[model samples]
Target: MQNKKRLMRVLGGGALYAATFFFDFDNEILNIAMFLLGYFIIGGDIVWKAVKNILRGQVFDENFLMFIATIGAFAIGDYEEAVGVMLFFQVGELFQSYAVDQSRKSIAGLMDIRPDYANLRRGSEIVKVDPDEVMVGDEIIVKTGEKIPLDAIVIEGESMVDTSSLTGESVPREVTVGSELLSGCVNINGVLTARVTKEFGDSTVSKILDLVENASNKKSNSENFITKFARYYTPGVVILAVLLAVVPPLMYSDQEFTKWLVRALTFLVISCPCALVISIPLSFFGGIGGASKLGVLVKGSNYLEALAQTEIVVFDKTGTLTKGVFNVQEIHSEVMSREELIELTAYAENYSNHPISLSLKRAYGKAIDNAAITNVKELPGHGVQAFVHGKEVLAGNYKLMKKMKIAYFKGEIMGTVVHVAVGGEYVGYIVIADEIKNDAAIAIQDLKTEKVKQTVMLTGDSKSIGEHVAKKLGLDKAYTELLPADKVEKLEELFAKKTEKGKLVFVGDGVNDAPVLARADIGIAMGGVGSDAAIEAADVVIMTDEPSKIATAIRASKKTLSIVKQNIVFALGVKGIVLVLGAMGIANMWTAVFADVGVSVIAILNAMRVLNTQSIHNSTVPAWEGNVEALSNA
Candidate 1:
């Protein structure tokens, strides 16, 4: 409604200005009145704001500069030029408001993910209430097409959830009993009843909204410089304009005060600084909005700037480069058959809930008979000991075999090895490995194509496993057997190796990785919704676990920075050249208006280019994927 009123005022002022050109009113008083009516219509707010600012001792703003220049033009009998300057300046202001609104729309669209209400299930009755009113441990019923109101564990029903809002992937994720469901996902297929695990304030959607809302407060260095530049630049130009007007008439008796005053007003019009003040911040804001469209949440422009300068990208092995879930890869036996070996290992590991043990049981794919198993004991960092069918069974690492005085053969394998022993005799070993993510290799290649100097992996896994995965992915270096503290120590070493202006980025997806994530120059958390600690500590969050998005983020940041630099250079370059011409009277008030307003419009349009990120996302595939495919064909 306010915009509509402003638009009407601009149109009315513009119509009056057009009248003077077409119809000639020879009466000077009548012509001046008509022009004054037009000027006050569009520029009244600006003049009023300048008055208020002056009263408060906050003078020399863009409003004050525009008011002084246009009012001076009226005083010099250039009525048309005075009103035309205000008309064009208002047009430029309108364009800036529109560009900022468009950028905001990209992020505002995500606000729909916040659930309006939740269906609370209490015994035989279901009641609807605000999502914030629903407490943890309450059972919530999510109907088909309803957004999940809070983080929960599914207790009944199965459905496909549309996680595109949170993960960016369009594929629907299947959920069943015992599956964890995050807030903001839509229940696409079936009704589901889940026990709420978190309150609305701590849910994924709430945190994401908070992160995005506060993102603009953390400005880049370029934005800070522009703010400071404008602070000093505006007052300095105003003082210079005063000197140009007063000193010239005092120095030369023949110099007319009105002629020099016109030049001073033109100088003030050219020196508004609107182009630099508006376009630089808009460029960064547009870039951030574009990134959010691709499901990448950059916490601030400062982080975006740092991401563009990343030289070394360090990664955690588990849940980062590789799927943290283990799978049984291979099995070898001497005294027992393969099936017998797996069966015994599965039964021995039945009581343990470790990922390695779970993989063994999953590979076994058979129900265990508790009557046949007895006296199970799990040793930390080793393995499990139990009796199956009256035979003593020891299933663990090679250390367990040596502790039992049983000779065992260590196989040449790139995985975690669990050795099996029967009645103090070595039987066989089972190899369990964490599978590498599909895009891990392509991600590494993309980073290299971006000219990253080093790509390193830090892992708590054994050396053999870490080196094998690193070699497969073509990483520059891999440090294995690292604890959480050791990963931080290694990051410091890598940090020292980076160029002074370059940054080190660490990517991880675990609670233990929070320290390293916070320590790095820029930390990116993968599968951000799955880990609260990672999301809290990371500077940027990749909604999906895809490593390729790292390259995508870098590309976005670099493009945004490029646009910002272009605006800075283009705005200043044109303004600088024209300001000199205006002072020497080579440029008229018309040219001065273009130098101030026209340059601002052009810079704003250039800044809007950052919001069109479809091309950036389309080019996110790393260059290595194509080269490797070509080599294979040869």
Candidate 2:
């Protein structure tokens, strides 16, 4: 629809410009003929819409103003001026179409993330099916080289998965049985059996699609202000133009009415309200486009603007600070050998579904031949009880050790303490700690480098664990033992601490973090493994679960803000010069066209520069200048 509207406008402008030359030969007849053609080609629709709006009691609009201005110009036989007005206004329309198309292209990049269909394996039958048709718990076979259809669990087989499109990482990750696979990740090699865990509509890819498609609904702050400015600016200019035509001639007793009336025509031509109107929205559209190219999906221009104001960034500990993959770092024991302890611990934890259990089993150094295992029982909310080789083995917390009639003397423990009771005697605890995200420290340092004033972490983890993670990351502060509501309180405190010009942003990726994520000034979610609650609540959704993207997002936001300011300054500067020239009766129609169309083109081109995500990390605020003035005096 937009393209078609743009086509008529372009054709109308070209024809009107050409009609001038052919009619220039016969002044009287030519002028009338050209004005008629120009009026019907451009102002006809405006006139119809104005009349229709009047009947509907929605009378005030740009179209009504345009219709009145052109007709008034033609009534005095100023055919050239009337055509020029139509021609330049149409040019502005074309410029707007181009900007809108550029925005659409940027939005299209995000739409590419949604999947079209899936390959389903039902017994011996392999049929092509829509991802929406696949049900939860249905076994879906993902072949080597195909994108995973939906969020699902690996039921069988193992393979290296390529999730660079989803996560920004270049390396392929190995996934085995019981691993949950999200949509948009491609299987690198090996056949894998997956059980669907989420429906297609609720998949991460789907939400991303919905976000991209509906992004335009939420107007950026700049766009909103421009819309309001245009509204008042248009009517104000029209009223002034009417005063110029009527009052000026009446006040000057001997003045020629045509001279003052000509000035009014020039005023109408200059007052098209296209540059500020087009450039502002174009700037936001370009920023949105550019950010998406870097795998950052900004919900609206408002979020982009909000991102630019961020001074404090809060993070969640488990998934956002760390990788959320627990690993058995070190095991301390006096009676058992390293190999014996790991074996017994793995044997005892075989039946548990906890993440720590899997980490211990992985550290066991040997695959569990399930057929050799004997009795296995699970105790919810605590740990697991199992018998290995007629030994009463217990693997749980300190409470579980006491429950099993074993005494556990508290020991100095750094990592998570997984208490063990082998043969009804308290053995030693395995130290299980969630591995920290490699980019955590660098991400924090990068945020500071990007002018982040305060970096904080909120977590439900113990203080010792939170402090250790925050210390490793070099963040400014850390808060621990936070429930969902507690995280919200911490966010509110961060908000209160910020300067009036600053904003507080929170990053979380768990079910417990959802409420705080929603309550934050800006929330960032690691879409992978992040609960639906977190994703739905977050303002900015990072498709990948990488901490580096936080820095990337900040870099993109600051860059976008720079471009937006540049566009606004350039557009207003050009229009201000032209508006002055128009009022003085020195500006020609060609100059007005250049101001309306040429300035818009430059501003739009500048806005498109935001799409280049490369070299985003290369730019810095040049801190040398800040401290160098003191050095010179010294």
Model 1 residue 175 CA deviation in Å:
1.9
lDDT value for model 1: 0.86
Where does the lowest 10-residue lDDT sum fall in candidate 2?
625-634
In candidate 1, residue 451 scores what lDDT?
89
Q: Which stretches of candidate 2 lie over 4 Å from their true place?
A: 1-27, 38-66, 119-130, 137-149, 153-165, 168-179, 185-195, 365-387, 391-411, 419-429, 527-530, 615-634
Best by TM-score: 1
Error of 2 at 632 (Å): 47
For model 2, residues 210-229, the per-residue Cα lDDT tens digits are: 77667778887777887888
lDDT (CA) per prediction: 0.86, 0.74
TM-score, structure 1 vs. true: 0.94
Could you estimate the TM-score for every candidate? 0.94, 0.84
lDDT of 1 by residue, 1-634 (tens): 6566668889999999899899999998999999999999988988999999999999988899899998899888888889998998888777667766765676577545888899999889999999999999999999999999999999999999999887777889999999999999899999999999999999998898888889989999989999999999988998989998999899999999998899899999899898888888888888877787777889999999788898999999888888777888778897879999999999999988898899999999999999999999988878889999999999999888888888998647667789999988889898887777778888898899888999999999888778877887899999999999999899988988998999999999847788998899998998557678767889999888778888888988999999989988898899889889888889888898889888888888898898887766734454443222211111
